[model samples]
Target: MDNLTHGLLGLAIGALRRPDGQRAPAPGQGPRLDGPGLRWTSPTDRAVLFGCVLAAELPDLDGFLPAADPVLQALQTHRGLTHALVFAPVWALCATGIARLIYRRARSRPVFSYSLASVLFAHLLTDLWTGWGTRILLPISDQRYSLDWAAVIDPFFTLPLLAGALWALARKRSWRRSLLVGLTIAAAYMGFRVGSREILVRRVERAYPAATRVEVFPALLSALSWRYAAILPEGYSLGRVSIFGPVEPVRTQDLPAELPERAADNPTVAEALVWARVPHVSIQEREGGVLEVRVADLRYNMGGEPTLQFVVLVGPQGETLEARLERGGTIGEVYRRWKDDRRGALPAEGGAG
Candidate 1:
């Protein structure tokens, strides 16, 4: 999910924490201080809001970490250690310490710490709801988990949360009620998406009885449209299905289930395979005995072409010449390096087995 949506959720959490009878003042107007030594007792003080927003977005801070490979950086680092459940308390403690220093008399340490930890947990849970995988249990296991209920960037999910946050920030009373309504709507929306995906999955399964496995992913922009991969004995079929339009797949393509040793053995390719859920390999013979191997995850496909892909250029002697990650491009742009006459061709059955 995007940072803006995360921040809005943080704002909503902060609003919920606001103490009774405490009215939120206009922007730039500080919270009303009470008690001896001018202690800031407001639970919805600046420190609390800062802590909430920070905790909400802190998991994504792993993106700053450096890595040798772009694919590893994106797949392993961005949502890796920081997003783990075990690290949530550690992150909360660190955030609380910072908030305490910034606002010395904001509130009780336990209150702030608990609120921060809750927000952090919410952030992780929200990430899990999206199609993009999240490594919730890092030290225990590196396996990425996802519900595939919503797209990473969904306005339908974010708008309600945003409206609640804005209402809470702008209104002096009944803010929590508004936030609750917004959260309820968002939860119901996710339920609808989950139910719709299940219906689509069942329909695909019934349509392709021979399929051994059927996986459905939420498409961008709308929940009604989904991308599915049905694994069969010979190969896998990838397609798009519209829940409202028809129970069957609107667009479908069959792809062979083969991974070449030369491509898979490459260090970069190996790292990407770890993260790819439904991989599609395209090997094209280019000029001067060069091989352009493109490995893409069907889960990230848009308009029939994959946006998240890894490309490896191999020399005639099977030596890796170039290895890089490609993101967000049309089919032509992604395969522009290959000649127009060339097409993706798999090697002999056992040649690259």
Candidate 2:
């Protein structure tokens, strides 16, 4: 999920409950974060509201950490250690301490702790719904888990939360009601998507009875449509599934089950093989006899092309010249130059000039 959606969810949560553990005041009779004639009546309320928003957006800070390889960096950063379930309590405590310092109210400690923890866990849960996957059980397990129920950015899912948050910010008396309705709608939408995915999977299985393995991925911008990949005895079957339509494959390709021999020597390719859910390997001969090996994950794609791809350039003698991960764009000149430099450094007997 994006930061805007997370912040809006935090805003709704903060307005629905009071930080001092007291029940929220009746409509038109409480401290409001905004709107005319409203003033800051409770410092604890302000502290808790901001604390929840900060906690909700804090886990993504792991993206700043560094890694030697782009593939490893992607796997270990972004949704890495900070988003782990075991570290939520620690993060919540830190957020609570900060809130206390800012508000100077020791009495709000328990409230801040509870609210912050809730927002942190909510962040992790929302990320898990997207196809990118999240390492919720990090340290204990580096495996990334995902539901594939929603796209990373789903306007349909975020609209309700946005409306509710706007209502709260507008200082409407019935803000709590709006937020509750929004949350309920959002939950229902998720349930519908999950059911749709299950139905689509079953239909595809029936269609391809010979498939050894079948998996469905959430398609971009539509809950009713999905992309699927099936492992058949001969090769792989790739296609799109429409809940209301037929289960016809888009295309079929003969992809190797393992990385190509030329790319196996590259460390980045090895790491990508482990990280990719449905690995698709392709070999192309580039200019000057360079072997361009592309290992892509078909789970995430746009316009029928893999969005997350790892590229490795191999020399004639099978030495790895350049290895890097491409998120969604074409290979840049920097990569070309890097490969040229590596090729230039090779021994005279290794390959042609």
Candidate 3:
């Protein structure tokens, strides 16, 4: 999920708790007027809200590392150890120390540390929804986990949380109530997305009964549309299904995705394979006997937009010469880039993969 959603959820968590470390009473249990509209103007409330903001955004600090290589940065730092479960408490303690320095009163308030820690956990929880995923088991395992239920930047997921957090901030008396409502709505929305995803998965399964595996991703900003891919013995089939539109097959190359033993050892290829769910690997011959190898995820390419791909230059005998990241953009732009990369390597010129 995006940082904005993380921040808003942190604020909601902070606002849901009263300054006295007690949560607002459930509906009908407290004074009817004291519901969400009750404003508690306590210094602790301010401190807690500030602390939440700091904690939620803290996990993203790893993204600031001065790593030069995008792949190295992605594999080593971004959503790496810092976003792991074991590191959340350490992060919380560091955040608490910083908060204590900024807000002297925070040193005496245990609730500040607790709230900050909770918000940090919230940050990790929310990241599960993104396709980029997070490495929660860091030192023990480098496995990345994702729900694939929502896009990293879905307004359907963010808007309710944002609105609720804003409402909590706007109506002092109703802060707690508004926060609860926001969290509830967000949770329910996710449940809906999950249910919808399951249905879509079933639909795809029915459509491609021979598929050995199927994966579905929520379309950008939409719960009604999805991108799905299925692995078949021959190759893979990918397509899009839209509740509002028609379900159709995705454009894909008929090439096999299996990596030849010789090319599998390249770290660049390995990392690209790890990152892509439904990958397509292809070979091209360029001028001067150079071989161009590409490994890309089909899901991102299905939309006809710019998508990440690993392009490697190799010798005729499969010795890797150079490898770098490239992207496929809209049809025209991708055509130009592909054309440029294959200059003087066409089949008429005796170039063969």
What lDDT tens digits, residue by residue, belong to model 3 across residues 30-94?
43335544434444656677777778888889988865456546655688888988888776766
Model 1 accuracy (lDDT, Cα):
0.69
Candidate 3: regions farther than 4 A off: 21-40, 66-68, 107-121, 242-247, 255-262, 285-291, 303-306, 312-353
Off by over 4 Å in 2: 15-41, 106-108, 257-262, 284-291, 313-323, 327-353
Per-prediction TM-score, please? 0.79, 0.79, 0.78
Clash number for each model? 0, 0, 5
TM-score for candidate 2, please give it.
0.79
- After the best TM-score superposition of candidate 3, give how far the Cα of residue 90 lies from its true spot, in angstroms: 1.5
TM for candidate 3 is 0.78
Write model 1 residue lDDT over 23-80, tens digit each, in one string: 5546555543321223234533667667777778777878889976666677777888
Best of the two (1, 2) by lDDT = 2
Residue pairs with backbone atoms closer than 3 Å in model 2 (clashes): none
> Per-residue lDDT of 251-326 in model 2, one digit per residue for the tens?
5656554545666766666667766777777777789878787778778654335667877787776676776777
**Which clashing pairs does model 3 show?**
36-174, 37-173, 37-174, 38-173, 39-173
- The Cα local distance difference test for each model comes to 0.69, 0.70, 0.68
lDDT of 1 at 70: 67
| True lDDT of residue 87, candidate 2 | 76
